[model samples]
Target chain A: MTRLVVLSAGLGVPSSTTLLADRLAAAVVRRLGGEAEGRVEVERVELRRLAHPLADRLTTGFAGEELAAALEAVHGADALVAVTPVYAASYSGLFKTFVDVLDRDALEGTPVVVAATGGTPRHSMVLDHALRPLFAHLRAVVAPTGVFAATDDFGDAGLDDRVERAAGELVALLSGTATTRTRPTEDERLADPTPFEELLRRAGAGPTG
Target chain B: MQLGIFSVGDVTTDPTTGRTPTEHERIRAQVAIALKAEEIGLDVVALGQHHNPPFVASAPTTTLAWIGAQTRRILLSTATTLITTTDPVRIAEDYATLQHLTGGRVDLMMGRGNTGPVYPWFGKDIREGINLAVENYALLHRLWREDVVDWQGRFRTPLQGFTATPRPLDGVAPFVWHGSIRSPEIAEQAAYYGDGFFHNHIFWPPEHAAQMVRLYRERFEHYGHGRADQAYVGLGGQFFMRKDSQAAVREFRPYFDNAPVYGHGPSLEDFTSQTPLTVGSPQQVLERTLGFREHVGDYQRQLFLVDHAGLPLKTVLEQLDLLGEILPDLRAGFAEGRPAHVPDAPTHAALVAARADQEVPA
Candidate 1:
């Protein structure tokens, strides 16, 4: 089954960032589920509820129960929808902090749909300059059509088409139309680890004892 | 089971009194604490090693030796001895000297020290922590067992025709435990050598501890040392107990809130739930500690961090007294329904006998 996770870094109770994320997630689900070969599950991670825990993790050097599960879900998903409000021409600190706390290899080669909400369209470059580069560093495959919804664009009719385009790109990737695949996940590596002898050899410390 | 206390040896101001112990006082307090452990019949006394300030465990062997000279039966160990930055030759020589001075009551845990600048300060890099641990420990393992050593490795200068002085006591090295917060490589290293695996159970969630221990045990069995259940495992914990659970909470809350590494992050309530920071009556502490075996299975060595975050030395003494009170029952609980085949933690005598057993005239 394909798992799609949505991380909405909107601080408000009814923030436009979350609205854009929900629209994109729904669009991907609709297209992926329509296929006979596809069975998809969706999980939404609201970053607001996890704000304190994220800060706590920064200080504590470990994730709490709720934050850990959220991280696990995001890492496990076949596709991800990450939306954040643009702040000072960048993704919100809350969004960036969440990404920073995730394991470096957490999103490797996972198809990600990047979205943003800002007060004006000028801040929309956050998708290219901030979000895409961030996920790129994580080795994730950012969907080509990024959906950016400014406050005015959310009121306009053009937002829906961008969401649809972005979702279609994500669905295509999830359908394996794109060859950007993943290395073994952390769980896979842990469950079937390299033999200690091999690791010792790599470290140049053989079993001389 | 070997019940003990492993102190990080941090110097923090007591929030209630707003007074911090001087390094001299803290040092003396730790020595006194270890002596008390021997007096009260606790099995082990371990200290952490840190190169940075606010932590006085930078020279564990010095402190442990001082304590060892005054005590007889109590085992001396480290919460961790930094295997990465410290030269293997030094670890071999120093710990071997300690083994002699302590009269065979010495063991140590290998750890990759965490503080970022500490690596570069020691002419090493943090990125090479796992490598340094593996390579250095390999050299240390050989140095302890072999009469002469010739070695070359990535992180250190090569050694040739060198012998570690004062070879291990009775030709038996102190037992080693590898400690890691979450690194699987360290766990695998521990398994590769059939060493004890120690998980610091107070910082992260219990599930994380269980996962690390599970990997170590499975790899231990894979390495053909013994059954998975028979592998040596040590866990670290924290507690603040009083006769009344509420009083325990009341007394420990300030220290918990401002403690380093995790302070000012999660509330005490949430932190207690996430990690093994049990602050309650002695009964609750015992039950919660005993509950650890449910997940990690029967294991050897249970160490508690009792003297950090500026809890006064007096309170720490009281905590040890309480720990001593429950240790017999805790030992019984750990020993209950135990398989006869599982081995207790190896002591010097046991290692000597095992060594003698391996040598037959055939």
Candidate 2:
């Protein structure tokens, strides 16, 4: 089963950022086996709810239950739809905070559809300026098309085209038809471990016989 | 199980009273706490090694030597000795000397120091942390066993036919525990050498610690140390207790809220529930402690962290008193299901006797 994680950094109950995320996720599911087919499972993470845990993690170096679960969901995701309301000309602080909580290589090679909702179309640059660079550093394969919905653009028909394009791009990458990335088989240095003798040899110390 | 107390030697402010202890007072307080541990019949007093301020245990050997002079039985150990930065030659000499001074009442834990600046300050590189731990410990292990060592490693200057002075007491090196907050290689290192692995069972969730222990145990058996369960394992935990659980919660709350490390983060209630932090009566502390066996299996050593985060010297002593009240019950609880073959935590006497039985240095 392909797990789709939608991370929305909207603070309001009826938030446009989450609405954009929902549209993108639904469009991707439609492109795949569809929601009724059950091949694609969607898990929505409201970054607003993770506020307290993120701050606590920053201070304590621990993830409480909710934050750990959200991180686990993201880690398991075959694809991601991240939607954040632009704040201070960038993705919401809550969105970045959640990103900060992730392990350095958590999203490596994962396909992502980046979207944002903003009060002004001028802040639309945030998708390229903020979210794109951030996910690039995390080594995610972001969809070629990124959706940016301004409050005014939300009513326009052009918005649907961008959301569908972004979803189609993500689905293509998720299905491995348009492959630009590989997860670089996990370095099993810790998982399976390098034998102690090899480590000693690498460190210029031979193993004791 | 060998029950003990380990201090990070944190000089923190008393949150409620707005009083920060002078480094001198905090340093002296550490001695008092260690002495109290012995006086109250606890088995060990382990001190942390930190090269930075806010932590004053840089010269732990000197402090442990002093504590050893005043005490008769309590073991002197390091919550961790900085194996990454400090020269292995120095560790070999100093700890062996400590073994002599303490009348063989010593065992030390090897740890890569957490502070990043410490590596550069000590003329080492931070990026070589695992390499340093691996190579340095390999050298220290030989320095203790081999009469004269010709050694070369990536992190340190080569030694040709060099002998570390004051070779380990009675020709039996002190047992070493490798400690790491979240490093897998350290667990593997501990297993490779058949050393004890200590998981600081605080700050993070218990499940994470369980995985680390599981990995160490599996590797220990693979390395031919013993059965996985027989591999030496030590756990670290923290608590604040009183006769009544409510009073314990009320008193520790203010300190838990504003003290360093975990302060101002998770609520006292949430922290206690998630981590192995028991903030309640002695019985509650005992109950939570026994639950550790369920996670890590039958174990060897258990170290509790106390006397940090600016809980006053008086309160720390009181916590020790409460710990003492439950020591019998705690030991009995640990002993009940533990098999007879599971070795007790290694000590100098035990090591010396074991060496005598083998008639060969290991």
* Residue runs of model 2 more than 4 Å from their true location after superposition: A177-191, A205-209, B360-362
Q: For candidate 1, what is the interface RMSD?
A: 3.6
Tens digits of per-residue lDDT, candidate 1, B178-249, equal 999778898899998999999987888888888889999999999999999999999999999999999999
Candidate 2: count the clashes: 0
User: Could you give candidate 2's per-residue lDDT for residues B1-362 as a string of tens digits?
Assistant: 89999999999999889899999999999999999999888998999999998899999999999999999999999989999999889999999999888889999988888788998999987777888888999999999999989987777889999999898899989999999878888899999999999999788889888888988999999999889998999999999999999998999999899868888887998888889999998889999999999999999889999987889999999899888889999989999978888899888888888878898755
lDDT of 2 by residue, A1-209 (tens): 67889999999989988898999988998988787788788999998888999998998898999999899778767899999999998987889989998878779889999999998899989999999999999999999899999999878999999988998899888878333323332234346877888777766743233
Model 2's chain B yields a TM-score of 0.98
Q: Each model's DockQ?
A: 0.47, 0.50
lDDT of 1 by residue, A1-209 (tens): 78789999999878888888889988988887643456777889999999999998998888887998999888777889999999888999999899999988788889999999988899988899988899999999899999999888967889898998999899888777333335565556677777766766877743333
Error of 2 at B358 (Å): 1.2
Window of ten residues with lowest summed lDDT in model 1 chain B: B126-135
